[model samples]
Target: MRPSFLSEPVRVRVPATSANLGPGFDTLGLALALYDDVSARVAPAGCHVDVTGQGAGELPTDDGHLVVRAMRATFDLLGGQPTGLAVECVNRIPQARGLGSSSAAIVAGVTLARALVVDGDQRFDDAAVLRLAAELEGHPDNVAPCLLGGFTIAWTAGPQGSDGAGGAGAGGGAGACRLEVAPGVQPTVLVPDERGLTSEARAALPAVVPHADAARNAGRAALLVHALTAAPELLFTATEDRLHQDYRAPGMPATAAVLAGLRAAGVAAVVSGAGPTILALTSIPDEHLPGMGWAAQRLAVDVAGARVDRGRLGHAERDPVAAGRKS
Candidate 1:
């Protein structure tokens, strides 16, 4: 049966996220205060997207857009497609700066599509949202935090939740655990002007790594959970990674140098996802210069992941320049 569409527009606020925080590659993620505001309404005919902030004129304005594609996928899951879609996006998150912009778009699309359907929640629940979003993004690390908020440990679970050890590799359902960050934990992102290709970064990583390195990463990843929640002081040691960073450093020399410098100065710094951007989990020393094409922003931890409301883009949300932080 075809699903009933809501006449009113539905909007979603999805936070920017940082994935693979050090050792927890493809498993751990953090939601930051920066966000993208997207609103969609059922239309009578064609699909149209009005993008403002980041992508603006560069992104596709039709169904080819990531947000629209996600929404179409969602509508299909909800049993039918609306006649058309009119999407408005006031994007604040950088497009390809390792800030989970793609995941944010995917989450926003799924959330809005679900809200636009009359009985959407009943048909596709929150867990289904996570699962679908993860499938769309091909990984749960970024989508989990963007959807559920805070610090999330996400993995792909096999039949009966038995695949606890799998992180996107198990290929079943998406599962995540959200935890509130410790009060003392501060997140500072050093964003660069150049964009990075996640595919390129992944290609740079070796197919195999030493066993000792994997063991070390496992221990630190475990400690990272505790440090992020209960002991901020231990974050420096806990955020260490023996995985993807070093191998991909040659491609992103600037990020590698800055990360090394920050760590030497006692800051818990890591390459944000597949980088050119750097995420510092601890306070940086005053001497550190965030200049040289790197814009540093100290962001808060967003506890409320993706928020949905029944409405179109208002004055502030349509501004394109202003980041629509929920009041």
Candidate 2:
């Protein structure tokens, strides 16, 4: 007989995330209000994935799906036999647009694995989940915010460090740390119709930067954190960067133009994650930003991060009472 926990499905919702936020560069990230919900159950046989909304038709519907792969990987890490899963994904975050779509999927998979197990067992806590997700995602920047919510400062500590675990198969040893973001900072995103791959954007960066530029960016990154927590008015100067953006500009001229125009207008704006999408830190409302025929939305800082709910049906299959409880 199947265990009681396996009698029903487990559903997880993970928020979209924006990384870098300008000068932080693979270190700073924050969660946005946007979300992707995934529901998974132990299937009788083969794995099946059904995707909706963003990337519905293009994404694979079999075991090759990223969410499924993440789930299997987590099971392996737990020293448990992999189970065939029936997974349904309702994706809201745009793909390959600098937003953390893949990170969200990775988080959802890990969360689902933790949620499906018996409660009394050695549970997969936040720290364990973060370590596993970081290993899967290759970095903690996006996954940390997706798991921890709010703002996150992610770093890999040295071998003697007290926190974090080393990357999968990487020779260097280090522990990962994801610190919570202080309050009062909000983001407004300018999403372009075109998409940009993270790999391509990463390849554009030069191996070495001038020492002066490096030093300046370091100062700005420190100031940016202070500005975000206390004096948001200083955001304009604090969000400056000397790395990654200019090199990625040629592939996203329109996005670069919008970013330049916003900064020139005294708004603190920078390329979100890799390219194409621009994240502007502002107290002003979205309706007030100059409409340049692009999609713009004001996003609240997500405080809840990824979560799981049991004994309830999927969003598409929920009853009114269940929906009310969810709300």
Candidate 3:
């Protein structure tokens, strides 16, 4: 069936995310109040993209843009492509800062595409949306929290239909559980001026870890969930990671230094996602800040996640400087 498109423009607000949360590795994420506002409408001729804030000049303005590619991929899944597209992005999330900026873009694109189509939500559904976005982003950690909000524990469900007779048919897709953060759990991100690649940070990890380290991380990862949800004081002990941080530390000495300093001061801090950015789960004293080269911002937990609405970019959404970004 050829799906109908909506004439009204659609916009989406996607929250920035911090993944790993220490020992949880690729399985945990938290949605921050920081966000990117994006809007799209079907065009008559060619694809046109307008960028306002971050990555305005550096990011692509046409079909090659990450958002556009994601939209195109979604359109393909929905039945057919629109004749043209006009996209406007008022970005606030810092790119390549281990803050789930790319995942936010991908979620916005997927959501905007679905909203642009009539009865799109019915056709695609929320579960399908999460699965597709996770597939596009290559992991559920960031995308899950970006889409569903709150603190999320994400994982890839193995292939289904392995009932001895049917034999695995297809993958079960991405799955996640969202939990409310305790009132005392404050999230502060120390973002660096320089960018760090997720690939490079990942490559620095050793192929295998000792059994004891793995076991210790497992306990801490479980404790992290409890500390984040119910017991805030235990966060300092819960957020310990023996799996990846130390191995990747040499590449990001500044981040390592600050993380160690904050932890020594009894702050529950961890390398947000891959590197360069540090996420402090507990409040940090003024005396412990790294001083310069890092922008520190305390953000609220976004419980609503990605929001889609029937409208173009309004005055507030169009503002390039809003969305809790530190100058």
Candidate 4:
């Protein structure tokens, strides 16, 4: 009677992210040139991910992987499950390299799953995507920016009572925004020849930071975000942070050395997500990047977030920016 509730498979492309961006620990993030492509072909109840490209050798090949987990969770949120899903992944972004590889997968899975599960109207809501991605990534800083793109500020607040894991909003409620990336800017990413620092390694930062150090970090964080949105000239000054970078030094040897060298060379690079990649936000052009030595490659900023293509399913197109009313 309901036309059989059939929807075509979907494709999603998500960009890798560099979180922290100097002093904005667990807050600031920028989308990068590298990417992960996820294509879903609907079959008949289970979902699976096929690993290829960059992380294939190291990453898992089954449903136990983070991406598959996120996709299945998306089905649960959308009401009922489809018959099955075969996910083809062409991952160019390296895992555990401090790039937001996990966040990228989670984003692609959620966006793709949403397109597959729902009807023409009640698709994955703004809050639904954000909340689920946030919960999966363990924090909103990297996940939010990777999902929304550009420059975003987000913070999570503790619930009023013992009620756990409430998605009230991070930083500025809904905690996402669209800021135009300055035209000439190119993010020089330095991914060291190292493995990665897990989210657990990141969470191990010393809880009690000196008040003075905290203030210094706060200043740099505000300056970095403001520079990104307002004045490009302020980026260099804003890139200095006294927070997580130094604290994370012991665990990430390459990260620490890269950050130190970049700063000494006046590039002011900071730890990218969790470890071996250092990101230098600059409009200084190509010649300057190579001099820093920690670089793998350099490219322009991709402000646009994940993109999903729908073949005929309701003739829908996934709008990366149209998440709706900022609650």
Candidate 5:
């Protein structure tokens, strides 16, 4: 069936995310105050994309664009054919910086698709969008929080003999649970001039690890949840890891050094996502910001993951604003 075109432009805002807060590996993620804004209007002709801010000159401006591709994928999955789209993207998340830029794009695309479709369709809810985004991104950790907000734990439900196992609209067997992040826990990120590819970072890890190291990481991951919740003081030890970070260290020595310095200073710091960007969880008052810097920004936990507005956006809302800017 043919999909109804939007009468007005649809605006979608998606938050940037940091995965593996510490030792949770591919299971934990949190949405940050950073965001990307995308607006779409149905066109009678062909698809076109206009980008500003990050990756303005390099990212594709056609159907090959990630956001547009995601939208098309969603339409294909829903068994509907949508009209051509003219999309404008104001991107803030840095690309390939281990900061969930790609995940944000996927979430934005799916959200935009949902917004453009006619209302009363039962298949376009949050869970359905999340599952689709995860499938497009090939992992649920980053996309879960990007779609649902707060802290999220994502896992694959896998095949079982149950009636719903691996069924359609079941998120391809993925599951996610959102956790509340305490008010005192502040998140700051250090982004370097250099960038790291997620694929290269994954390639650096060994296929196997010592059982002892795995056990330690598992314990710290559990402790991290508590530390982020009740005991902010224990974050220093809670964010410790015996897995991926160390293996990725060689590729991003400068980031590793910054992480070590932050840890030494008693701030809970770890590689943000894959590498290159370091995330520090601290309880220090706003008066005192972390001193050592490549390019650092203090961000808060985003309670709202992604939102869609049905009408035209105001000037301030449509413009490409700096990340974490006070409104």
Candidate 6:
């Protein structure tokens, strides 16, 4: 018998996210101009994936696909089932280049899976959807902004209550509070070809940092929010970090140089996520920026976070007006 054909595919578009800007560590993040798109298609009761862009030569094309793994894990968390799957990818964002490629894929999987199980109907709860994305992506900083738009504050537990814990989707207890987003702002993502720092980067630091450093970061994190909203000029002083960036320098030499490049050009930049991609908070205008040549690629802020369509997966429609749903 000939193979059975399935209905049209369920699409998902998860935006590229930047995390740990300066002092925020796992607590702060912003959505960026770049994106990696994932698509979930119903096939004949099995699993298959096709990866193009960035890591196509190195990434998997079958059940082992990271995008597939993320989608499956999401459904598992929600007690859903797999029918069959196919994935088509577009690689506007660079992989392993510190641009939230992994978070993008994880969000895509779960978001698309939910769309399929429910027949691509209904507006999936944004808060609940982000919780799922955070679980898979390892934090809400990157996921939340990608899903909700604008700069966001995410918290992670201090791990056994060490007093540094924070996460946006926390439980009702005092430590578990909701994160917020503001409207009408633009972002700029500056990515360099320098390789990314792995989870191992944390191993280079002492188990504990000085309280002075912690306090300093707290002030900057607050200042960053102010810069994002009303006082962008403060960013030159606001985006400094005593915690993550200096510690990971060994892993990101080019990142350091590129950051200096941005600052010298009067562009306020922080290390994107862990490192490698420097997230620059800026107001968008046709006026050109100077000394941006060092970056591998530069893009404007995209307020539209993770979303879906019939022909694509988490495929974002660019205009906030066209989104039809508020961020």
Worst 10 residues of 3 by lDDT: 162-171
Q: If scored against the real structure, what TM-score would every candidate get?
A: 0.96, 0.87, 0.95, 0.84, 0.91, 0.79
Ranking by TM-score: 1, 3, 5, 2, 4, 6
lDDT of each: 0.91, 0.77, 0.90, 0.70, 0.82, 0.65
Q: What is the C-alpha local distance difference test score of candidate 3? A: 0.90
Task: Flag the better candidate by TM-score, 3 or 6.
Answer: 3
Q: Tell me how far the alpha carbon of residue 201 in candidate 6 is from the true structure, in angstroms, after superposition.
A: 2.6
Which number leads on TM-score?
1
Q: Candidate 2 residues 284-306, lDDT tens each? A: 44444646556777788787889
Per-residue CA lDDT of model 3 for 205-303, tens digit only, reads 999999999999999999999999999999999999999999999998889988999999999999999978999988899999878799989999999
Better of 3 and 4 by TM-score: 3
CA deviation > 4 Å runs, candidate 5: 161-172, 283-293, 322-327
lDDT of 6 by residue, 89-126 (tens): 66556677667887787777767776766532333455
Those runs of model 2 whose alpha carbons end farther than 4 Å from true positions after fitting are 1-5, 119-123, 161-184, 283-293, 311-327
In model 3, state the lDDT of residue 97. Answer: 91
Give the Å error, residue 118, model 6.
2.1
Question: Which 10-residue window in model 1 sums to the lowest lDDT?
Answer: 161-170
Q: What is candidate 5's lDDT per residue for 26-49, written digit by digit as tens?
A: 989999988898888888879999
lDDT, model 6, position 194: 52
**Backbone clash pairs in model 3 (N, Cα, C under 3 Å; residues 3+ apart or in different chains), count:** 0
Cα error, residue 264 of model 6, in Å, equals 5.2
1-327 per-residue lDDT for model 4 (tens digits): 121234566777788888888888887788876677777867766756676667666676667777778877887766666677777777767778878888998988788777775462266676568768988887888777778777777666444444343344532223455567776455777766667667656676887889998998899887877788777778888888777777778887656765676677677577787777778776334444434435466755666788888652221122212311111
Ranked by TM-score, the better of candidates 1 and 5 is 1
Span of ten consecutive residues with least summed lDDT in model 5: 284-293
Model 3, C-alpha of 126: deviation from truth (Å): 1.1
Clashing pairs in 5: none
lDDT of 2: 0.77
Predictions ranked by lDDT, top down?
A: 1, 3, 5, 2, 4, 6
